[model samples]
Target: MHRRDFLTFSGLGVAGLMLPHARLVAAEELLAPADVARQKLLADTVLAAAHKAGASYCDVRIGRYLNQAIVTREDRVENVVNSESAGVGIRVIVNGAWGFAAAHRTTPEGLATAVGNAVAIARANSKIQSRPVQLAPQKGVGEVSWRTPLKRNAMAVPVKDKVELLLSVNAAAINAGADFINSQLFLVNEQKYFASSDGSWIDQDVHRIWLPFTATAIDKASGKFRTRAGLSAPMGMGYEFLDADPSGRYELPGGVVGYGRSYDPVADAIAAAKQAREKIKAPSVKPGKYDLVLDPSNLFLTIHENVGHPLELDRVLGYEANYAGTSFATLDKRESGFRWGSDIVNFFADKTQPGSLGAVGYDDEGVKTKQWDLVRDGILVNYMATRDEVHLLGEDASHGCSYADSWSSVQFQRMANVSLAPGRAPLTPHEMVKDVENGIYILGRGSYSIDQQRYNAQFGGQLYYQIKDGKIAGMVEDAAYQIRTPEFWNACSAICDERDFRLGGSFFDGKGQPSQVSAVSHGAATTRFNGINIINTARSLG
Candidate 1:
């Protein structure tokens, strides 16, 4: 389990933060790469042991996962940590059944024992197996390496520098008249090595970063409070993500600062404080059907739940039912050419897009990654599939969606960066707004609810504006939109072009029985959905 699983930060000390899978490490170790020759040598030993024990196929993953979190509130630094986990997981097919074992030990004897257990488990499970496992054919590249193109490694940056940045960000919020604020920076590095009996030797170094914070404003006289959150997106980049690149900033209407490839947290905090104060007196929505204009920050989560999760082949095939429920987009629906959206709607599943969390050269299972269509011209075309699941789709090659959160976790089909395609014609959010008659413009993610099947849902946003007669009238509060999955996508009438495109994502998207978190990104331009149901949340509460 990750640190987020059971972390209660109220009174925990540094020792308490450590898990068996992760331990506090020296700062220098964070930048150090694991030895490749030694990892292959260790893997070869495990493979030979599995083969000797009646295995037909074998693979090993040796991973070094590193993470750093710095949390601050108001004027004080709450916690700072640098942790690392290093281990190996071996999987084998014995008697046509899959088995797996993991160990922290890199010694040959320890790996041999893990191999013995894996083969034995597979042999026992084969007796009751429904059928032999089928994996699509894969030709491995003998030796290859890939790394996240980086200018500076965040982990290598001084702790003092990061802390000072956070402190300054908090001060900015306070100076703008915020009652309270919380800010945090999360950085992760995954150094992974994969070896298999199929002659594949692969190595990958991945980096991801996120800086999130909330600013609150209170009206002491009215006993009311409102908040605004930072617009920064978690990204697959180096420390440069925090830089205040003016070219990367989007000054949306109402003076709301929208971040793209880079962010300025200090500036965002200043804006957030001012926005939160304005939210206090913002008028309540006069709930009714209205066109909705959704910024990427707010639309990304919607795409993640309604589109990304439901189209996983594992979910549609019923092999996965733990993340709330299985998918409604079943095989028959996909094969029958289900209309998922308007002719203008296009969505793709990509794992190779630069600066995306899921942008890896190869998946954990050693398949070369690439982009493919999930929905093309509004028709359901495919589901995200791995080497083990591609046979269900009658495909010979994997979509390369396979991933394991850590060395000890079993590899499985995970969502990639599923994103909406931009409009072919030149368009911008400003131009798109001019065409609207009556609509609500929503920015950033807020409270959301979706059904177990990921069908019916309601979504809220951090900032909302009423658009009347082709213009933003002013701010509004307690606004949300309701949707039926198909109706929602089909309602997509207009989408801004690439110039307005931006990425937003979750750093910890949890799925499975023993839930594992995977970081994923979703990109979209400003988009418009017609005649959606709007709800007055305050009415429901009262």
Candidate 2:
């Protein structure tokens, strides 16, 4: 739904440039915090109505969402959009069945009607009920608010400033030898209020921003093309991410640079242009087994698909079977302590990590947010869960992973900010690379494919370098690696220490039947996998 450059630029494979959303929101129209007393009263009305209608439980979400997008190509501004959406969604459990209704009207009468409709629907469903809903106990922390610790609200920044930043970034790419460039800035602000019959009234102010672009290089004589995308990761911060800090940048092996607390899109665009041009002439990869060094940018998506999605209890329990498909990490496998990775592999689902997209005071279902392990010491330990799904795993409380893309959408279990813990040994990517004689250093996300169970998969990246004699030899193209999920993680021989950790994520990770988009982050230090099956995609294509 995001607006993006119309110019067709290919070669990224499956990881195409992210377009701006179609919705727009004016800055001034963004809703300010509503009076806490007033919102609680509104929620009380809905709760009272639901209880009167024979409901066992009820919750309400009132949300104000603001979005702004600035898109530019080459020397011209392509588009600018601003828009807002506000609504309330009511959910209730009646006769042991769940039902939901939403309305844009904020009036007490309107909410009461919506609650009535939800109860009616639940009753109708209960006629054919299989079993009653079983939700884990949640002791709500009454009446609280959480806000993103933003120094500068992106909504307060002028649209002119955003447009200027995009234009400047495009110019940098063009000046760096890109034949064509497309850049965009996306900003979001969400003001949400939640109230549930469990005696919890919570409010939250959330902000997120992404500056993404694609740079292309073409060889007119050969009629060949190549492209590279900006290395900047979409952040949970505000416009402050635009201001580069010297301390935040990390110098990696092979002259590769990684950002920490902030990013510099202009610098990334310049590098992207150079990398794309080099890609046009980079030698085709020679197919064979090789030690694969995956940068965080490239590895995040792999973890998202193969690890994050598969660990969702809903997916494993067969309650969710849409979009990307069900999980292979079933309860039997987890209970048996299946060896999912190497001893160095420890993956956890965290919703409280600072600056994480999933960080929040509580989940949409009013459960307190916390961190829990999915895999520990390379063994499957747990799965992501919501209030309703945790009981399947014998857990007493939700893993706090419930989410809804909008106020009008029904809340459901979603993936949290799952991450691979860093190596305890004080290792570094540069140090790890020195030990590799024959390997491929892969950076940034590229085209990828995974099976329904998230078992078998192939992955590509923005850049690939051949390593020989403990040094980066040169660039290579059309390189990809294939692996089965368990085998892939078991092959993880090395992971860099915390000093090199960085976050990589998608602003729009789509899942579910109605396909709601959720933002999630995955953090890892540079990692090495042994003897991965490297293939020459270009030769195979021809």
What Cα-based lDDT does every candidate model obtain? 0.89, 0.85
lDDT of 2 by residue, 314-391 (tens): 889776765567888989998788999999999999998878778888889998899999999999999999998788
Count clashing pairs, candidate 1. 0
Q: How far in Å is the alpha carbon of 442 misplaced in model 2?
A: 0.6
lDDT of 1 by residue, 1-542 (tens): 12353143212533333434898877777888789999888888887888888899999999999888788889999888888998999999988899998989878778888898888889888999999989888897999999999988898899999999999999999999799998888888999999888889999999999888889999999989999988889999999888888999987765677989888999999989999999999999999999999999999999999999999988888877754688899999987999999999999999998899998999988999999999999999999998878988989999998999999888999999999999999988888888889999999998888887889999998999999988999999999999999999999999999988899998888788777778999999999999999999999789
Candidate 2: C-alpha RMSD to true structure equals 3.3
Model 2 residue runs over 4 Å out of place are: 1-25
Residue pairs clashing in model 1 are none
Please state the error at residue 522 of candidate 1 in Å. Answer: 0.4
Query: What residue pairs are clashing in model 2?
Result: 1-21, 1-22, 2-20, 2-21, 3-20, 24-82, 24-83, 25-82, 25-83
Model 1 deviation from the true structure expressed as Cα RMSD, one decimal place: 2.0
Task: State residue 479's C-alpha deviation in candidate 1, in Å.
Answer: 0.9
